[model samples]
Target: MSTILTYHYVGDAPADAGSHKSLFVPKHEFESQLRAIKKMGLETVSPEEFHAGLLAKDLKRKVWLTFDDGRLDNYELAFPLLKEAGLKATFFIIADHSLGCEPGYITVPMMKEMLAAGMSIGSHTLTHPHLARIPAEQLAREVAASKQQLEDALGVAVTSFCYPYGNFNAAVQEEVRAAGYLLATATIRDNRNCDADRWQLRRAMVTPGKSRSRFRYMFSSLYHWLHEWKNRKRWKPREEA
Candidate 1:
């Protein structure tokens, strides 16, 4: 079994950011979390590797680190830590939010630097809309167009899709598949076992503040068991493989 962790931002709050700043973690905390994860021997894999591992049932002690929205903090803060740790991760980027258009979003150069450093990139949709609430046509456009845009911009195949707000249904899942995405991730906090669905892969959200012990226990077998037990009834199992 393997756990996939989700992060939004990793930097100090801006003065004007207000309550929206809750999504960020201080740079030190982020580094500490990565160190704790690495100390536990949880290897981080790209989305493609994760998919292959799931199919081969060879994901023991492996974990996938994912960041949502193409934030500059990912390039400035997290990328160096990951490189220093000898780890790789998939960044789910909003194509529209990238480059010089959006303030605080990473530019194309930064993305290229990350790719050169061995990081993978994925699509977080064109505008980051809620996939479940949108119309079918709009949903298809969001899923398909974003992949095309990211591939065009980054000059690499963007095979992963992350559901904005973790809102997706069967139809949304199929839309992602039809969009040519090899994997899709949701905010379900549990280890993805052998029976994991490639399109609806689950992930645990990383809060800003947590002790090293809590971070260590996150990858513990007992913690995963407790998480499964608590969320089992609330989460429907994936379709049989």
Candidate 2:
């Protein structure tokens, strides 16, 4: 099995972040977490490499680092730290928010720089909508059009995708596949095995305010089991009721 870690903003939360402040991890904390991952002797891989490893069944002790939303803070803060650590990650971009269309998101030039530095890019949809709730035609556009836009902008074969808000259904998965993505990531909190579904691959979220020890535990073998156990406990009462 391999571990995939998901992150959002890499700096302190801004005032406009509102209730989603937890998505913003402090810069120092993110740096420390990278160091911890290194200390644990885990090798980080790009999305393409991770997919290759999965196909070869050689994913033991491997980690795939992923960031979503393509926020500007990721380019300003996380990119340098990752470059310093000699680590490469995949950033999922919202096509509509990029290319200077939005103020706080990453632009085409920033994404090009990251790609030039060995980082990978993936499509996060056109506008980051809830795929499970949208109409089929809109879903196709979100999935397929985003891929074309990113590839046209970056000149790279965009093969990876991430579900917006981690919301996807069977239809969404099919749309992603039909759009030509090799793999898609979801917010499912668990480690993934080689046999895991490519369209719904699980990821462990790295959020803010976690202690050093707790952060380190995220890379341990026991984390997934504990996470799932707690989730089952949280939902068991509802199932019974």
Candidate 3:
């Protein structure tokens, strides 16, 4: 099985980040988590390798590192550490945020630099709207236009899509597929076993203030088993008296 981990901001969350400040993972903590992944013998896969692994069902001891929202801190803080660790990650860009109109998010130049350093890019929608609640026309534009914008700007064929805020439904997913994306990731937390759906591929979010031990547990088969069990129990039907 393969694990997909999600991250957002790196280092301290700036005051402008507002309520989303809780998403910040300190640089030290992030570095320790990366080291723990290495210590546990989990190898980070490139986007192409992850896609191929999903198709072949050959993922074992593999992990895919992903960062969402195209934050500049990701470029300033996380990029160096990843390079130093000899690792690669996919940064899901909010296409509109990279157009220089946004203040805190990454720009197209920064993304290109990271890509040149062996990182990958994916689409995170045009405006990061709630995909499940949007109208059909808006949903279609959010999925298809973002891919076109990112690819046009980055000069690469973007094939992966990440649901903004992990909000997606069947219609939203179909729009993504119809847009020609190969895979999509959701907010669900679990390892990608052979039977895992590529459209809703599970990802465990790496939040702030997580301990080294806790981070280690995130990669454990036992943790995944317990997580799955809890989810099943939560949704399971109550027995009749």
**TM-score for each model:** 0.91, 0.92, 0.92
Instruction: For residues 1-241, write the lDDT of model 3, one tens digit per residue.
Output: 6889999989987779788877999999999988988888888987678889988887787899999998888999999999999888999999888875599898988888998998999999999999888899999998999999889888988888999877777788889989999889888778654434778778878988898888877778887898788757642332110
Which residue pairs in candidate 2 collide?
none
The TM-score between candidate 3 and the true structure equals 0.92
TM accuracy, model 1:
0.91
Candidate 1 residue-wise lDDT, 97-134, digit = tens: 88436988887888888999889998898898978889
Tell me the lDDT of candidate 2: 0.87
Ranking by TM-score: 2, 3, 1
**Per-model CA lDDT versus the true structure:** 0.83, 0.87, 0.85
Off by over 4 Å in 1: 14-22, 236-241
Using lDDT as the measure, the top candidate is: 2
Better of 1 and 3 by lDDT: 3
Error of 3 at 186 (Å): 0.5
In model 1, the clashing pairs are: none
For every model shown, the clashing-pair count is 0, 0, 0
